[model samples]
Target: MNGAESLVETLVDNGVDICFANPGTSEMHFLAALENPRMRSVLCLFEGVATGAADGWYRMKDKPASTLLHLGPGLANGLANIHNAKRASSGMVNIIGEHSTSHLKYDPPLTSDIEGLARPLSHWVRRADSSDTIAWDTVQAVEQASQHPGKIATLILPGDTSWREVSAQVELPKRVAAQPKVPKAPDAARIAHIARVLQSGEPTLIILANKATRGLALERAGKIAAATGARLGSQFFTARIERGAGRVPIERIPYAVGQATEFLKGFKHIITVETREPVAFFSYPDKPSLLKAEGTLVHTLVEADEDSALAFEILLDELGAAHAKPVLQQRVEVVVPQGALNPLSIAHALSAAIPENCIVVDESLTTGRESMGHTMGAKPHDLINNLGGSIGYATPVATGAALACPDRRVFCMVGDGSAMYTIQSLWTQARENLNVTTIIFANNSYAILKAEYANMGAGVPGARALSMIDIDRPSIDWQAMAKSMGVPSVSVDTAEAFHKAMADSVRTPGPVLIQVRL
Candidate 1:
């Protein structure tokens, strides 16, 4: 068997059966090996599509899917979404192609360091030294990716190694289970310290993220808050948060450092579970990086890899506060709003119209943050975000999420600017007939960037700078574009119109786009 064949067999043996791919010359052999009926290969028009789809698949399936990229440039094209996947804690195996070892000595143009590019975002990176080692390397990659909380694993395969013949006698490595992260028990001294701080009559806040954002961890934290009057909050961005109707709701820390500092200033104690104290996403010229108030004490209740639920349970036991009922939000029936077109009205309409058993792919940036919180009480649904802070991921991720969970409807929310980044995702959605409702907030500009410019302390710009922020010189016709890509679509300008269109699309089934002109 050749190296490519052995690699495929090894991956299938390890339970990685799906591959999202946009291949080039170096990957031709691996592509051919995909003919094996055990492995399914999905062709994507762009590398970003491939990576985003893998991300969506992991979100639903909780299993790693593989992506086959060309050379360094192709991998670079997919890096943004891969970064997103990593942030989401979505596991994925990236099989990147490289020049043959023999050709590498001459330092060809495509010979950029794949390992260097991948290290920042990936938890595990490897390059197969020869055809004989491909099987073992592939197995390790799968193992790393399948770790708890998920991880990104990149395995580089050179062309010569892929096509080279390997001995059939070479045995595939045994697959090992990923190690589980065990939560450290709080010591008696630490527990007493926290207890004293809580009883000191000073304001305190408990911040949650990762496992603490959902299920028992959140419930326990709520109980602790109720018992001690501590404020409960989360980081501005999270991997996955189990929120919405009937679930415990925790407030998110404001994004701006000034606002976060102001919000947290009164607290004398800041306890963190599975996360750290609030910090600015970016460093500003005159702002402090940490958002905690001056003289506030920071305490670590649980580490990121630890089991937050268990830690909270222990804390509650030590405090003699178990059996305290956590506050839960009552689920509300959907009520469609009637008003002019605006961000608030759009959120209300969405809360009323999002169907039951649906998945929300949110990339609406500034517009959808409040909207998402409003919809939490409306229905039980899954919410996916661009965890990597990258734009242009929602559309393709929605497509993959739909494919992963065919029974659930997918409602993708994206801005006009971000949608154009990977609009090709619509074609794939249409071809698959996946039930997806795409809402494009057509403000016709890079709205998020505008906010960033101000946050970064940039002065109000002249016409030329403003022009770079604007995209309306030739406004895109989303309805026409959706139709051209074989997906039915409509344009709406009022809340009433958007509500009607969204309701109709959900009821009828199949893929449809609703362009909200703002």
Candidate 2:
């Protein structure tokens, strides 16, 4: 078998069957090897889409997905989403193609430092030295990616390594059969201390993130809040959160520095679970970077690599709150708005139209600021936010989520500005026929930047400055764009029309786009 074939076989045996690929000449052998029916290869027009899709897949499947990139430049193109995936703690295995060892001596044009490009975003990085070692390297990459909370693993494959023949007599190294690593249980003394703090009757907030924000871990946190008077909260941006009606409600910390500071000022203590103390996304003039109030004691209940569910269980036992019933969010009946399509109306429309058990990938910087709050009492669903503060993550992530959970629909909400960054994602969605409904809030500008300008202590923007934030010079026809990519689409200028579009898109099969004109 060739090195590429061996690598593909290893990936499938390790439970990584899906590959999002954007290949070049260096990956020809690997591309040929992908003909193996056991491995499903998806073509992404851009490397960023591939990486972002892998992130989405990991979030939904709780497993690693592989990505195939051409070279250093290709890996560089995929880095932004890799940054997003890393911040989200999504597991991904990236196979980056490299020029042959012989070609490096000539200093080829495509040659660049692949390792240098991957290190900042990847948890593990390795290069296949020979055909015989490719299988071993592939196994290591998959293992790294499969860790709890997930990790990014980049495996660089040189051209010679991919094409070289391996003798039939050479036996590939077997993966040491073992169970995946479980998160360490929190220290008993630490849980006892936290239990005491919770019972002190002091106002406290338990901040949740990562695995702690969902499932039984969330339930345990809710019980703690019920037994004590402490509130349950989450960071402004989280990787994946299971929320809405019938689920235990957790307060979302405000995103703006002033608003967050105001919201947090009432707390006397902040207990963290699998996340750190709250902090502002960016520093502004005359503003504190840390969001917690002065003199507030911060305690860590669960470390990132520690088991949050176990810690909560221990805390529950210590507090005698094991039988406490957590409060759940009740369903709210939202009436669909009619005329204007402002933020409030838009939020109401979404709250009314969203289906149950769907996935919501949110990157609507301007319009979706209030979406989470409005949708809190809607149907139960999984919500994914961009933790890395990167734009253009929603559509691609939605694409991946749909692939991972074929039975569920995916709603992608993104602004027009952010949508343009990875608009190529729509084509992949269409090609895959993924069940994704992409909503574009077409304000035709980087509206968030305009808000940030004032937030940063800058005065009102002049005409020239406004020009940089506006994109209305020639308004983009989103319907035409979607149709060109083989995805059906519609345009709406009113809340009612947009709501109808959302409801209708869910019933329709395959990918669809809704352009909400502001």
Candidate 3:
């Protein structure tokens, strides 16, 4: 068998069944090997879409999905989304093909420092120098990606290495075979210390992230909160937060620095689970870098790489709160919103329409702030936010989420400006006939930038600056845009109309779009 075949087989053996690809000539051998039915290959129009889709797959499946890219330029094209995936702690295995080793001295047009391009975004990076080692390398990459909290692994394959014949595949060593699959439990001493702090009569807050924000882990955290009267909250941008009615609701810390500072004022001790001390996304002039109040003591019960769920379980037992009934959000009455389209009305409309078992991919930026709080009581659903602060992730991510959980509907929300970046996702969604309803907040401008301009302490945007932010001179017709991509769509100018469009799309099969003009 050829190296490409060996690599594919190894990936299959490791249980990575999907490959999101945007292959070029250098990757033909890998492409040819894709005919093996063990692995399903998906074609993405853009490399960013492939990487973003892989991110979404991992968030749903808790496993790595492989991405096939052409070369350095192809890797570069996908880096933005890879950055997003890395920040989100989503597992991914990227196979970035390179030119033949012999062709490197000639400085070919496609040749570049692929490692340099991948290092910034990848947790593990390796190159398959020979056909004999390619399969071993593939398995290593898969293992790295499957670790708790997940990771990004990039394996660079030269064309010659992929096409070369291999007598036999490389096997993992005995030591590698014995490596533990389970994450190590948190330190007993540390958990005890944090428990002591929680027992103090001072006001405290428990901040959750990663696995601690969802599932039984979150329930245990809620029990701890109930027992100690400690507040529970999460960072503004967690990867995947389990929210909605019936789930224990953890308040998301506000994004605005001043607002977050005020929100954190009452807390004396802040214990973080699977997250770092809260910090501002950007360093604004004169603003403190940390979000917690200056005197608040921040501590860690679980580090990011540790098993937060297990840690929380231990803590629950230690605090004698194991059987404590946790507080849950009550289902709110969904009153169909009426009147003009604004953030609150849009929020109310969505609170009324979002279905149970939905996967919501949010890249709505400034426009989504109002809607996020309302959705907590809508239904039991998964909410994915942009942890890397990257735009264009929602559409592509929604497409993959739908693919991962075919029985559940996927909802993608993005500002019109961000949607334009990976809009090709709609075409793939239509072609696959996936159940995804993409909502475009058609504000006709880069609304996030307008808010950032003020936050950055810029005096105010002049006509030229406003011109750069505005897309209104020739506003995009989203309905036409989506239809051109084979997605049925509607343009709504008011809350009532948007409510009907959202509700109707949920019942329809396959992909659809709703443009909510602001």
List the global CA lDDT of all models: 0.84, 0.92, 0.89
Residues 1-518 of candidate 2 have per-residue lDDT tens digits of 99999999889888899999999999999999999998989999999999999999999988899999999999999999999999998999999999999999999999999999999899999999999889989999998998887899999999999999977887775543124668887999998999889989999999999999889999988888888989999999999999999998989999999899999999999999888899999999999999999999999999888999999998999988899999999999999999999999999999999899989999997899988899999999999999998787888889889999988989999999999999999999999999999999999899999999999999899999999999999989999999999999999999999999999999998999999999
TM-score of structure candidate 3: 0.97
TM-score of each: 0.91, 0.98, 0.97
Which scores better on TM-score, 1 or 2?
2
For model 2, what is the error of residue 495's alpha carbon versus the real structure, in angstroms, after optimal superposition? 1.0
Which residue pairs clash within candidate 2? none
Candidate 1 TM-score versus the reference:
0.91
Give the 10-residue window scoring lowest on summed lDDT in candidate 3: 171-180
Better of 2 and 3 by TM-score: 2
Between candidates 1 and 3, which one is better according to lDDT? 3
lDDT of 3 by residue, 1-518 (tens): 78898888888878888999999999999999999998988889999999999999989888889999999999999999999999998999999999999999999988899999999899999999988888888878988998887899999999999999986544532223114457768998999998899889799989998888888788888888888889899999888888888989889899999999999989999999888889999899999889888789999899878887788788878888888888888898779889998888988998888899898888887788998998889988899998998888888888888889999988899999999999999888988899999999988999888888999999799999999999998999899999898999988988899999988988999999999888
Instruction: Report how far off residue 157 is in candidate 1 (Å).
Output: 1.0
Query: Which of 2 and 3 is the better model by lDDT?
Result: 2
Root-mean-square deviation of every model: 2.6, 1.1, 1.8
